[model samples]
Target: MTASPRTPSAAPKTDTTDATDTTEPAAGTGRKPPRRRKRAALLTMAAVVVAAGTSLAVTRPWNTDHDAVQSGPRDTTTKVERTSLSSGMKISGRLSYDAPTDVIAQGQGMITWLPAPGDTINAGGKLYETDGESVVMFTGGRPLWRELAAGVSNGPDVKQLERNLVVLGYAKGLGLTVDEKFTAATATAVKRWQKATGLTQTGRVPLGRVVMLPQRTVRVQEVPGKLGSAAAVNTVVKVSGTALVAIVQPGEDQLSQFGPGRQVTIRLNGGAEIPGKVRSMTPGSGGNGGDEGIQDKPTVTITLADQDAARTAGQSSVTVTLIGTTVDDALVVPVTALLALDGGGYGVEVVTDGTTRLVRVELGLIANAKVQVTGDIREGDTVVIPE
Candidate 1:
């Protein structure tokens, strides 16, 4: 025989009892009614802690059914204005070069010469001399890792060296083409360059004998190496780009509000404000990379359109305010002008020549305690608020 299906019963309802339960008053002594006690119990439920251990009773202020009061002739009002409304955040940043290049040593010799701080090193210029052999700067995007000579493997480094040689006036009549192959003509040009820089004329370019930098010119910031120190693959000097920039380290949350070409205002240490735009943004893991001094945060680079203004605020801590979410030609009013309508929205009391009427509005961004609104609002329209 088949069994009959059992009917499922409804789940029991749960009652969330209040923390301060209402109780009936005792008879006599003109005690308050249960309604007042229930109301008091509800208000007690909204008690707020004013300090560490003290509590105070609080009441709700948003009442939709409240009566609208009439304003006297002396009541003050605010006029709605049309302007740009924006919301954003401000962060602290440093004004410096846009990723300065650290010059590390690769030659194996004593540091006999070091460039002074604030010196400008250009292409074909001597960065430092090791054991009386000058390590000359060259224009290239690749770092020199191996010796470039005849019989070496063909690669892009050979072409880069050839380009440098051409600019150094060494590849005039050697009939050499700027390519990946290491040719005998390239060796001849190397010999000419060696002779010009007082290096031994070996017709070969040794690793660490030339410093290849991506930029043509670099302004030296500091010489970390002391004269007569052993030259190794260590940071000897720090060089920065000629152009200055403001770098801000923001997290992923703040990065979402940023992009390329956004306008920003930088407040300098000396209380000067300058305008700039977002140049670039690099996402990072906020890694310390074994450096305790540097906070591992994502970086944002900003470049000022006015170069002269940047010169005045060199290498200092500044406050960076990123402007985000801008609405142009917007009708705005004070936030106090908003009132809860009887049904379900917000409205502002529009005051014309001698009459006042509540006009419903569509709200937009709220900035600086002012709200952007639309719908039946015009510039110079007077709006009423609580006196």
Candidate 2:
């Protein structure tokens, strides 16, 4: 049969050519155009060449060889022998304690003399009472004239302050009250005591606070209240001796890597290191109201595992080291051997064939200036140790 003659539809009528073009595709659109595989291959090859050239251009060494990696300082000294080691932490710490001494009042009152110089009081022993109010709230005990004393301390505040002075190793008599006057000696003692307790060194008792008891040896005999001073009830006194001392409060940073039954080294302020061990770690915060008036810092009390002859309670400072981190057979390197990088951990420059190579390292326990490292370097391999 003959097909009827068909005429093409009139050119699509549209307001805009762009719109008409969007409505339909061109003729021959049913079959895809021939693919230009060779052209694509050429473009891809050109891109790969450009990328490779760019990479070569940016690389530090144009012709990298083993020599480039060998340009660091060579090790003349034998590499430290390898030893068994595990990860641990190290820090600088000051020895401290939360002692069980009788918290004394600065008066010659009854409870002042209860605990003898060598007496071992209970952790919560009731040695003295701060009757009427907390020392932190003392307001010159209702006498406005006391302020005119020019930094003078008196009343219950005087007794409390004086008692603190005695406990701080001040030789002032148990009846030694600073009167309504502030003495130079009194001020000096107060400042020293403040420094030791990590308190502000203002001579006056800030809101009338108690000073920390002296380090082990020094003791507070008594806080002398002014004789016949018309003050609220009799003033209280404190007596603390320097015998049988132990560091009760060791800082959190100190105990971070240490565990129980570890040996400890105690280095007292102006004294030498005395061998000791981790006696026990008391878990609790002193609620001490810290150096600032916020809550007391959370603290751990670590007593001496071994006796420290050089210990002095209430001393200004001491250094402590916990023993658990010690590595008897660990591969240790000088800290100077490692160079700090942007990220955590350190790197060492290994000396090989009169050149240096940087080797990345993972650190283990740290003691003194030496650290344990795990890396490509092996035992007997010499590395540059910075002077």
Candidate 3:
């Protein structure tokens, strides 16, 4: 009990030591730096997340689902014939016929000129009568006996007979040009021509004799007069030929569309449709309705493809057509199936085995709802139209 208390005998010396309570505000020099740093980091992370979300909303980057909104295999077409041929390929081509000869002039004083130069009789055209109208030239139709004697001394009958020789495919023996002068050369060519033509004359061009020429002239004029009345030694009458042609004009826009070697068909003014080809044309097509404010119309010449004596006899006028290029055995399809891709190209959706896949395709030579395509895709594959 109190035994331990006896040790405190001397009153503790009260040493007065000034002691300040060192209770400082937890070393205030050290600030709460870490807590603020952690808060700042948290805030920065949140801001970053927001920015990322906004960027995603604006950009709306690539997405498979969004890629969605998008998108006559009639080959074996023939140009000319609808029915398939056994072997020959069909082509659109024009038909050209030979131009006919014409003879002109009748009851002439002196046969001034002739159309064709050859002496092939009845070559088909008009003939000018050798009535020696002009002293320099002479030519004409076959002369009858009654007029023969009268023409020999009165007109250029002999000269006319000689020139007729030249037109009959006979060579001018005396080198006489068709200037209409009576010459021995004319006699030789005429006689040869007469012999070839089965005429009764000897191998000599005689006065009052008329010979025929092959081929005719497009135009002619007949002179009225009595036989042997021509001023020149001998003169005769009877020239034969006619004039007929049709001119057709195409639209100005159709100029390029028309070309050489193009097939054409026409329905004559009063006849059936006749096939033909482009014979010739004016430099260019005119304006609207084919009128360039000019008196004459710009026209194209068309030669009949086929000839019919009866058909041509009727009053004739015609229409013309110009052909265009075409292809055969071309693999084609409905133009609608061609879908434009987003990347400035073309594509097609192919359906194979119940699955559809889009494939890029290259197109070539598009015409009339049909287009040529080349790619890994083969023909006969079903195509899915893009919705």
The candidate that wins on TM-score is 1
Q: Over the stretch 86-192, how does candidate 1's per-residue lDDT look in tens digits?
A: 66667889888755887888879999999998898888889998998998988787798898899999999999999999987899988989999999899999999
For model 3 the TM-score comes to 0.37
Model 3 lDDT, residue 321, Cα: 38
Q: What would the TM-score be for candidate 2 when compared with the true structure?
A: 0.37
**Who is ahead in TM-score, 1 or 2?**
1
Q: Rank the models by lDDT, top first.
A: 1, 2, 3
lDDT computed for candidate 3: 0.39
Instruction: Flag clash pairs in model 1.
Output: 286-296
**291, model 1: CA deviation in Å?**
8.5
Off by over 4 Å in 1: 1-89, 267-275, 289-295, 321-331, 340-342, 348-359, 374-387
Return whichever of 1 and 3 wins on TM-score: 1
Better of 1 and 2 by lDDT: 1
Q: What do the candidate models score in CA lDDT, each in turn?
A: 0.70, 0.42, 0.39
